[model samples]
Target chain A: MSRRTSRWSVAFVAAVLTSGVGVLLADPHLVLLSIPAVVFAVYPHLTRPPAATLEIERSIAEQDPAHGQEVEVTVTLRNAGDRTLSDVRVVDGVAPMLSVRSGSARHAAVLGPGTETTFSYTVIAKRGVHRFEPATAVLRDASGGVTLETTLAADTELACRSPIRTLPLGHTARYAGSTATTDSGSGIEFSRIRSYRPGDPPGRIDWNRYARSGELTTVSFREERSRTTVCCLDAREICYRSSGDDSVHAVSYERAAARELLDAASDAGEPVGVAIFGVDFTWLAPATGSHHVATAHRTLEDPETLPIVPPTEWDGTPDDAQARELRTRIGPPTTVLLLSPLLDEFPLETARTLRAEGHSVTVLSPDVTTAGSLGRGVARLRRENRIDALRRAGVPVVDWEPETPLETAIRRGERR
Target chain B: MTGPIAIARRLLVGVGAVALCLGLLVLFGPPVESAIRWPWDDELLLVAFFTAALLLASVIGPFVLIDDGSQNQNQNQNRNRNQNRGNASPGAPERVPSTPTPGRELERVLDSRWPASLPPVRRRRIRRRLRRAAIRSIVRTSNCSKETARERLERGVWTDDPVAAAFVRAGGGPDSDSSRLRSLVERIRFPRRARRTARAVLSRTEEGEHR
Candidate 1:
């Protein structure tokens, strides 16, 4: 669409006033003064609006970027029409969640027929899948009287996943698995020798004990049990709080942690489940398989399940129903790895509730709180109090600050 | 009739063009001899006069008299078009400042009310919030009841600093009219007093936690 700017209307008004006064005064010079104004007013109408046919292509240097890495985005605009475009202003529609760290996303240039211009910018990669919007090009004619605005589409996406360096160690569950337990059973590691009983396997009997005492005795070994872990991610809008510039929300960190926890559990051949508590409760029953892990990751990637945009309006109440649903799903012998920012009281309550339900709950809270404003200071103090309360209740809480590496935080958690 | 009008318009445009060229020549070209009188001097003057009238009308015709309705519609259309394209970055949260100092919130509140005397109600509200924080800190660290914490705060014995204690002490009122000058001094020292009080409470909280 094209529209006139009417910028030279002042020239026309000046011309008429001068001509009217000249006629009344009968002065030829006054009339002559209106000539330039007339020319200025008519010049714009003579030139036509720019015929702009632009094709834009966007390219990202690294589509799969590491967390917090700067990625370069280049946009190439080609004037595909036969007419020269005198003034073209292109504003690239960068993803809303991503911030441009360097360079310009908006460019203004003069493009002749069959010419192209490229502009590059750097954006700090955040965790999540970010898709770029179309570029908007505003083309103006030489007269500046008319403008034509058009949108050029280019599909580009940035998927940044934070790598997990350390696996969570020293967790136990029921059933036979990799890690050795204290229970005496038929395993490689010897525990103690007992009096031999009927129906005991000959291989299980301790041959050395039998040879030494000439008595029948049964041998027991330490049991190996597979761990059942549930990586529960808090996706409520309240968990979307973030502190400092260029930082992703706490929900994003929780999602990343959940992904890593799932991978670790799956690798260890453990039955792992994922619970996403947001606007709706999404649950994946505990199971062990590559497909289950892939499904969990895919669910985390979907915006509907865990959105990049923080919800603006919500019920603003505690998610008691969601917590009830989760508690019913997880029982004894299953460890619940709760990843949350602990911004409000609900998460603390939820952790305590789950712990009270006989489930082993370990909270990995990513600290997104800052200590500047009175409100923020109070928030930080309250969060510390919450963690302290949880610790006093015998629930181990890992206070994970975002600036530190996840592995280091896990090690610190293990030590405590 | 249409053909005759068309020919007249074309002839008028040609005369205007010639007169414009002559005007430019007179402004920027070599000086013409004022003594050089021409045979068609009156006719040349008539042509210049007619050209100026025609040019003036042409300049004013489309913009002043005939463009009112169309221009507004065009502007409305352009605005709508821009609005349609403005949804490219919807729901993007604003980036927070990287360097935010602790107590900046209190600083902001005080700065916004600078120069103007803070209202008594606003002062009470700020003091109320501070008192609540002090009480919570005291109750947690000292393992005392909330009532006892409140009582300690009211008695101005919660902190070692007298200024901080008075800042959040219950029943702390504005100075009497007799001490008008002294009250002015107190108003000037409000921000500093608030900061000191906050620091004292926070320090107590920290110390209690260590203990």
Candidate 2:
């Protein structure tokens, strides 16, 4: 919109207007010719669509799904104007980690009467805060007139979390006197009490009970440690996506859970560790102190590229040696919390193996499998089977669909 | 290809548009000659409408060319590739940007040949993505034929997208696309299946008992 004056256009217009009276007025031929030329050449730019007028909205068909499932995205295109929109194409900019299929971004539509059109597509996200930016609708007149580009930052987001596991924490691990043990040393609930054994500790002995029992019967109350387990998410390109500017719900979601878990653990002073499975493992050995929790957070935050040594349990290759080596090098097992999409068998098997080795395993996998309408049933079945196996193996499971609050799922499962 | 199709189509739509515009123009334009009256010189009006229609189309000719978005695909891919790789730290040459990577010692891609000249930033991005993709592809790929590997790539099945996109985008210049990258990844000299098989066999209990 520099002045409506091109030098030639201005000169021509000036000649037509200021060429005073008789002789110029006589030659009206020039005026008609000039009008059509200018109109034809300049109409497009003048008629270009307004950038501010376009609005976009997006909805995730299912705000939640199992890992590796597809999620449908329904995008609404609204014309907030009096102008007839032609050649309006809308592309919902997706995060790089998602796989989008079907149809082109450039929609062919003639929306004139306060119109709204919606385009539906599907994608499978790993796990995390999946942001949906505004749809970029590139509008041009049917005659390729001035092209107008609109960017609507609608700020739509969907949070994908893992599925629930039925097994309790004790299923993942075992305690000799767990039943009457009251499991009080560190857990989420109150179990029970037990009689003093031969090696009764004076600190834990119920003095009141001792006075009554006529013997030193140590009062063993179930230890209620924080159900806070922080996972260390590996955001490095290799673990999930390979390149730069890539995002996977698995990476982001795992990182997100890890962050929350670490925060909760830190506040509650519980042990936390993360075994990053990328090219290798980035192990933050489980420690109970708040400092260790902070370390887990920092490790999760590290900008990815660092070489990671994966814990042996989740090794992609059927190589148990690595898992054996990791197991040997590791200290006392805390809860083995695996935050992944579980696209492959590695993470699941890792959880199973951890349980087999006397470690409590909790899997937080974002349900990518049950995202869309058609495949949801099958995905649900698969998810059910996975949960069943973990439960049968005595590992507590928490199945989460995307967009459902992770905390709610964790609490419900624990209570159950 | 792009504009004026609507207007042209409308006019040619028989009585609906032709009669409308011509009726208006004939009622309005200055008298050409006595042969053409102010209101109802049917032949003259027809001629005038046709002439105007031809003139408008001829005037709008050049602008009709549609610039298919294909032209910009390469430029976008290259720019993104570089932006991604440059973000990785220098010390970790094989580092992928987002999903984890820290491991002790591992076999590098072993590319002694200097890669074709590319913008340094883009090259770095490609290299990083390639490294990450290589590892991930190795992990994801079952020990199968080159055809199977290629099929997986074509399906866009890998979990690591940035690396895959970069690898695919970087392998071919303007001529490259996702399909092309899929093929190239399959052909990448590493016998990825062999390594995986070796690792698996070495880990198997049967083999372990012998060891």
Highest DockQ scorer: 1
Each model's total of backbone clashes = 2, 67
In the range A1-416, model 1's lDDT, one tens digit per residue, is 66676677777767776765665555556768987787777667666578858889999999687767899998899999988899998878776567888888889999999999999999988765566767767889888877887777887888775455544533543233766678988778879888989999999987887799889998888877676788889988667677765566788778767777777677777888888889788898888888888898888876666765554455543489898888888865678888888766677888888777777888889888887565567567666766766676777888887666677788898787
**What is the C-alpha lDDT profile of model 1 across B109-199, one tens digit per residue?**
5434464456556666667767767877887788777799889988877789998898888755565564877777666676666667777
Residue clash pairs of candidate 1: A177-A226, A372-B102
Off by over 4 Å in 1: A1-53, A57-72, A80-83, A95-98, A124-133, A141-161, A165-231, A235-240, A245-247, A262-307, A315-318, A321-334, A372-375, B1-201, B208-211
Give lDDT tens digits, candidate 2, residues A12-129: 3333332222123333343333444444444444344433355677788776665456778777777788777776765566643455654444455667647888877777655554
**Weakest 10 consecutive residues, lDDT, candidate 2 chain B?**
B101-110
Q: What TM-scores do the predictions have?
A: 0.59, 0.39
Scoring each candidate complex against the real one, what DockQ results? 0.11, 0.04
Worst 10 residues of 2 chain A by lDDT: A1-10
lDDT of 2 by residue, B1-211 (tens): 2467455544445543444455445447546333343343465554555455445554433323222334245324433332233343211111112442211011222222322233434434434433333333323334344456445444544333433333433232233345866545544523232223223322231232344
